[model samples]
Target: MFKRILSGLLLAAAVHGLTITKPASADSKLHEADVKWQTVVNNGDLMPTAACQADAANCRTFNSYNQPSLNAKKRVVFRARSKGGKGGEPVHGVYTKDMSQAGPIVRVLDRDTEVPQPNNLSAVFIEPPSFPRIDSVTDMIATRGNHKPVWEYTLADGSDTKVGTTGIYTNPFGPLITGASKLGAVNEFAFFEVPEFPGTPFDVFPGSPAVTQGSTIVFKGNYTVNQIGKTGVYYRDLKNQSLMGAAGGGEKAAVLIANNTHTLIPGTQTVFGSTAPPSAAKRQAVFAGFDNEENPSLGGIYLAQLKPYPISKQPMLKTLVSIGSQVPEEPKDTRFNRLGEGVSFDGRYVAFWGAWGDENKIVRLYCPKEGNKDRSAYCMSAASGSSQDAVGWYQDKSVPINQGLFLHDINTGETVRIARTVTDFSDFVYWNFSGRSPGAGEGEEGDEDGEFARWRSASFLAVSSQIKRSKDDTPYQVAFKARTGALDTNNTYQNPVDGIYLKNRSEKSPFATLIQTGMDGTAFDPKAVFVDEDTGVSVVLPVTEMGLERDGFRNGRLAINASMGTEEAGWAGIYLGEFR
Candidate 1:
């Protein structure tokens, strides 16, 4: 038979208080008694059940009797009855402070009810107040009443303190005030003001604020008012209040702005010097998108040189391309795809991936030398039929390649395929074509379809993959490589058939090395490699992966954005180890 019972009482001691004991357990059968505290059900009805028995103050029973061992400590259990003839009801247990003869305490209901109820009653363990302990009070002024009604509390020092107008009582923490409406009770209240960094006229209200690492807090919000002459951005410092800083034009400043198409490409600046940049000295760059007023073409690129510190001189901004100007017109139609995976500047040449005509994939190169505009920019064609998927340029103006790698002279526009093959066009047609296809017919002309082999890059390292077949017609090896010139059949690891990722080393060297392997699923898609000329190490940022994966690598940080179906969630994270 099911028999509910209460076992011996257990005491939960607090951090700053003395320990206390409750009623001792008896070596006898316990009888159940209805608890004064009732639980409100989902249907808006209250149900009364025996929480525990007299002898067993902490023990309760459901289908199977739960009898505490004679010498065991007391534990309380609350059982819920199943509805609609459902068999056994599950019992839940909770620990509370020891209360020998306490009646009841109020517990605020978490869920909403039919009527607006303030609070509810529940049985709980209460610790007795320590002697000479003081509790600070705040006055809560009643807005509905003609004369303000105040709630006050007396401290341990025999001093009566008034809790002024809707504030919470805290032991040592500062006052948590609840705001009152101008004419009636406030429907909502929040701590919107930035406590540590005060006196800035920017929007401080966050949609969701999270407290991190003791005193640090992070939140996101939109700027509502852009007042002229006001600081645009501000950061609070706990160590020194006087070290606070702000930036941007009040009325015209926007960290993130939109283009004509309403695509959001906001302005962002990263402060790197020892001291924060003054408002006038701060350098800003805009991310191009449809919503931005300046640049409307989707694949437009720009370059600007800003002063590192001091507000004395204005920075120089240069327009790299005005939207569709990068690509050519008509029969030589230039299809502008998304910006290639990577970008970098070496104070000399700027290299990027560009698509021309329908089948001509090439690498676009530009030299920043003064007055060299007409002859400064040119295209280096890739392998005859292969697309130049991604590209990167080293500090010395050397191009990197992957898949169909090739090299071309900037001055002459001369191009050559880095890797050569012994298999002729006829061999490819004979193996891949059939009698039904034109190439396989007895009298039909055989067209070469084997021109698909192209290297991905020529600078840094170009990695590619291919399945090698054994003499017995069995798949033998998967090859990968990072090649500068033609594929070196002599060096095994030098031309790895399995994909590889290269990063620039940071030890004041011009050379870069393979830092990651593409064989692993976690490895990013190798796109463009950016190497720190001072350090030989480099960072590899991938443009697309198995599942439309896109990533960005800057400095030593990596960011990955993955889209799943209709919903997308991503995070910018850091990875250890220099790109060697």
Candidate 2:
């Protein structure tokens, strides 16, 4: 699951030119990690004075691109905004850092670059596994305003050697699903490839799906007639252009959830296909129903199991979670919206918003625990005054729901108040204070019985978990961090550049906002530091003199957006910082 660190003096004592050692405590070995923040691309770096109209005043870099990508080599790639635009054009150039030690910027494409479709050039995502196979210009998925986006890796290389396009989807009823009908009603390609995990075997499968017959594309096909439309999760085999799910604008297929795939997994080949039963170890998707109907046909969540490659059949859909099963978990007949499902890496569990209202409530183990009477507790109220840590010697007074991230287990229906959040949330931000068993593949937290079980926000980056204690031979509430939107303003806390947190589980509540900020003794507060709870090993990121901001964490890298300041002061720029 994650790498581990040792508890000992980082540096061995050298007494009189002789190496010496001493037995030290765990805290004694804790240290900080380096956070190297570099301004990957700024107006000063890219939109230089020469690029402007002879420095006729302030020539700011108009940056429409905020999401930056980092490959295995740590090379940065992002879209840059142009000074001017023509027609419906949006993004400027696809750029990357020069591989040299003093990495310079390199523009891959200009604002007026020719595209296959009438799309507003948005952002480029590097397919790391596909990058090396090709040339300097990596293989990537370029998403724009259009439904039929061009994922042409050959085009991304900037060699002027055109290869392919996602030819607009053809509809059997009238004509085709073009980019023009985007009235919240268009068949749009949402994601191109499966998301990458640290240990996942593959990232992207570079292919000529037309000739090779192996390309896979997931899209949201919306069917509209007289202001009425039905959208559903669509699967397309890029080779022959076959379809799955309700792409034909079928009756009842009203909406398709974009982010229904599991964390770090893109799920299956077919959205609805016939495949052999999947083992629990394999990756599967727990998505909201495809057809919006009252019947159980498309009720709560359906599991899409993957089939072997060259599979052109529709995926086998099983009711992973049913709306009927979920209705009982609601607050005593309180009407609620059908929550989308959040699948755990382990196929057995699914998390979702149990109930939403004044209180961001959750329901876990609605039925009963592994060994318990029927109609037991639905929520974690019993643990309300107790510590979930196995040996629960202390009672946690209460955790407010205003800024908390809760998880609802669909299987056992046991509720765990994972995080009492504070600050805000950042995307793709992840941290491992004390890591897991060596080479373990996402084993359940507290799987070691007395060991702590790690729980995390299924949708966001906020995280919480149990703690293993050595003395008691049982796990305890050690520490947890919740991403929040606001903090105790009465406490006079500064706004966090990165809105994630880490708090000790022992404290009744979070005392201060646990993020690194305003310590550089400068006006530009760009330092985004992540402090590990157990070791106190802080990863301090580099803060440029100019104001810097980030939208969210992309995996482990911080892509600098607008923190606080103008473009001339380095607002519209691309900054990349690795949290080692």
Candidate 3:
């Protein structure tokens, strides 16, 4: 394991801290890696300007699950979306993260393909690709023909030997596949039909199809157990391409993994659903979702896991700091109930977002103590000068109010905030989408339909608030604000904390050493890339100015700014961070 020398150093720093610990290594220095961005494609290459203006549906780049992974060629894989879902035109494409292998972008398949593919499609993976981990690989879930999901994988045992330059392998798409059959075609008895026998992965009818042998396509669609009487939740097999909780046991499909029931409380309209694209690989699927009400305060961000088989062995589901869900430590702190976006890889740490208001009516920092569950039940104040009791907590009126990114260890019950809204980070994150020519968008706001965000690897996330106008006809200056191009660089505004914010999260506490600060005696826009140093998470290298622009945020605000869904929803350019 990597040395744990940092923890003791952190405790001592809190005794003489500026809220954030000081950085002691080169890796912790802001922009330590000189994180520069490399742009991809001309803005016009996305979708037509008229199309986006016509409706948000017409101009989606369909870029989802954007964490780059190599194909057999080692090129980055991403989705090109249009109107998505069952018939959306989300074509898969590839290129280099640095655009070094530059050429025309390669489309995996489209209507013009030899087989003439469908229009609607989305590419979501259970595991993500990142830097510093070169020899690693992951599995992917993509559209064979929009929603007819197929698995694109590599052989784990190297069982499928690759032939020389000819680019042929014994198993091109790897084994455990049934070749790629549609949902209905696989099981003659339909997934939701009554099971001829229970406790098995098969049906009971004589005409039921055989246990799909080749590769079968799966669908993550809506299903109901009317006869058994169930309302919400779904359980689908990641490997075998099958659906569960349909035939037997009226058990609520409302579970995450095995038996880790989230605060899902028996039965309540405390609504919950997958809030972000899920990350998956071999036997595990790491994901985030939320339980909410009309009042934002009643909802919370949560992290959960799902296993392909024997679904009972699900990993634990931790409340990664539920906003609306009362904190077990401070049950009486009822005013702050909330939630947010998140990501995970290989079931490591589940990092998410959350926020709570304060009576201070201003932004501030609050640290907690792992006291003897019996120590004074108050938040630690910096005063008593020691983290031994409720003395390490303090508020700085200069900071923004509530909201922050957090990480939770599924294996361990530890959770910590990487940065707080308006304090450590500005709420208004930024991004670039060279698709939309600049005008038209925003019917509603939310990250529900792959709109406002993109999770790169489990440790990195890029978030944006609204959009802005084109300055100098260049994509780099598209400032994000409630109004078009309202950001005045000359003014020292407190700002709503909006703009593109790249958060490098970890399950560990603040670093023991702080990065260098700006002239104002503060560090704004510090770059960080969190990788597991050994048994826990730590910053390996500080990235420069929030990383690249992979995809558009949700389709919303003052004309095509950012969110998650619809790639061409705004006039912007896509860039990959130079993480050297």
Give the alpha carbon lDDT tens digit for every residue of 480-547 in model 3: 12101122332222222122323332213232221121110112212222234565654322111122
Per-residue lDDT, model 1, residue 318, is 39
Question: Candidate 1 lDDT, tens digit per residue, 1-580?
Answer: 0011000000111221111211111111211111121111111112222332233433322111111100001111111221222243333211111112221211111011111101012111111010010100111110000011132345667896432111111111121111110111111111222222222222222111111111121122222223521111111111111100211111111121111112222232321111100101012221112222122234333333332222223233333432343243223433343222222222212223232222321223222222112211211222222123233211111222212212222223332222211210000000011111212221111111111211222111111111122122211111112212122332111211211222121122222222212211123222223333454453332211111000111122212221111001111111111120
* Model 1, residue 117: C-alpha shift (Å): 34
lDDT of each: 0.19, 0.29, 0.28
Root-mean-square deviation (CA) per prediction? 30.1, 19.8, 20.4
List the candidate 2 regions with Cα displacement exceeding 4 Å: 1-34, 47-64, 69-77, 82-110, 117-139, 146-215, 225-227, 237-303, 306-310, 318-418, 422-498, 501-562, 566-572
Clashes of each: 72, 24, 75
TM-score of each candidate?
0.22, 0.40, 0.41
Q: What is the lDDT for 480 in model 3?
A: 16
Q: Give a tens-digit lDDT track for model 2, residues 1-580.
A: 0012111111111211101111111122222223455656654443432334464443445453534543324455554564443333333445556323547565443433333232344322211110111011222222222112333233334653211122222222222222111212122332221111111111111111000011222333323233433233434333223223322322112112232232111233323211110111123434554223221222445555544335534465555444434333344543333333322212333333323234432212121232111112211234322224442222221112333233334355543443332232311122211112222222111111111222212232211122223232221121112232232322211232332232223444433232222222111223333334566674322222122111123223334342322122213355554442
Worst lDDT run of 10 residues, candidate 2, spans: 127-136
